[model samples]
Target: MPRIVDRDLEALRETALRMGSLAEAIVAKSLRALATADPLLCKEVQEDDLEIDRLDVAIDAAVLELLATKAPVATDLRFVLATKSVATDLERVGDLARNIAKSAARLAAAPRIELPGKLDQLAGECTRLLRRALDCYADGDPERARRVLDQDDLIDASESRVIRDAIAEIAAHPELSSQEIDLILIAKNLERVADHATNIAEDVILIAEARNLKHREKLERAGDRRT
Candidate 1:
């Protein structure tokens, strides 16, 4: 029975990691759509979101089954719970990626306007954060997970600057307001993706160190040094 439970747990973890990879691909494709303004790629992102949703439901079911059957305790229990949390965050990341793709679709329709360079940089940074967070999970490395937490501040600062620049451009050219709105939304989605990545990294830390970092007052100071 113990051996069977161990195999089930391993399968659950693998499925969740596969789900993470899909979500990461969504982020990458969404960014590519924004850069290329390709309608087909944007449509692909929307389609892929459905698969991510299905994986989310499957992960939840697997975890609940483990809880009911295996009755995991202590560290094992924490691992299962943290896996659920990470899956939730990754689903949200998929949603954000779809939103970014939707905005890119809108941008494609509007008059051609060069997207901000900072927007490109922000997308790259946020993607890196997501990738590293997933790596931390696979390796169960809290130290590497902490490094992902450190990256959140940089993404936040980049997001702020992107928003500021978009606002300024809109003010200068009111006629291009539609494209500007899309640009702002894209930047917002990228920021939200970074946030989801941070959430996943925090969960990784919790699973590895057995320390619940959520709602800790001191850790709030970590966001102070933006970039």
Candidate 2:
């Protein structure tokens, strides 16, 4: 016979996966909204965000209840803690998606920016990073999480290149001057989404090691300052 604790653990895993899927959906929809400037798609993204917020609240309540009632220790405690962190990251991801959608909605009536191929490539990279990071967090696969982090540099570079081209286009074409700012902002939003994916990967590493690497670079900078 399975213990209630065992059942609860299984439920926790399911809930975490659900949250991840919701986040992934948001990412995909946001990209569609960006690419198409479709008001309907943007509206869908906005509507989906309510569910993500609800899940975040429900997950937080469930995790808190488990902690208070179960007194979980060691690996169990780690799982619950990691789950809470994942929920937060997922919620933020949803918010980013909503922001992108809203921006697309605002630009709906304007002439399309005709983003270069590099923008599509950057978005694809971000989508991959987000999907992999979500999987890693869902399955507690630290290796996959690390790979997601490794891929972020490529996305960042691509974002920079696209933004540079957009800026140049704006300078060369005065007619596009008005929409360029929005396009640049959208590129920045996508870049930030990649950054959030990196944070999720870091959280996975932290959950596995019980050590925080988040400030590792900052610490190095501080050491250099002292030196």
Tell me the deviation in Å of residue 69 in model 2.
1.1
User: Total clashes, candidate 2?
Assistant: 0
Score candidate 1 by TM-score against the native.
0.93
Question: Which segments of candidate 2 are over 4 A away from where they belong?
Answer: 1-4, 224-227
Shift in Å, residue 148, candidate 1: 0.7
Q: For candidate 2, write residues 90-191 as lDDT tens digits.
A: 898888888888778877878876757887788788878888887777677888888887887788788889888878988899898767776677778788
TM-score of every candidate relative to the true structure = 0.93, 0.90
lDDT of 2: 0.80
**Which ten contiguous residues of candidate 1 have the minimum total lDDT?**
218-227
CA error at residue 39 for candidate 2, angstroms = 0.8
What lDDT score is found at residue 170 in candidate 2? 83
lDDT of 1 by residue, 1-227 (tens): 24235677688789889999999999999988988989999999999999999999999998888887778887678789999998999999999999999999998888899988998899899898989999998888999999998887799999999989989988999999889888889888888888888888888888877877665545567663321
Q: lDDT of each model, Cα atoms only?
A: 0.87, 0.80
Clashes of 1: 0
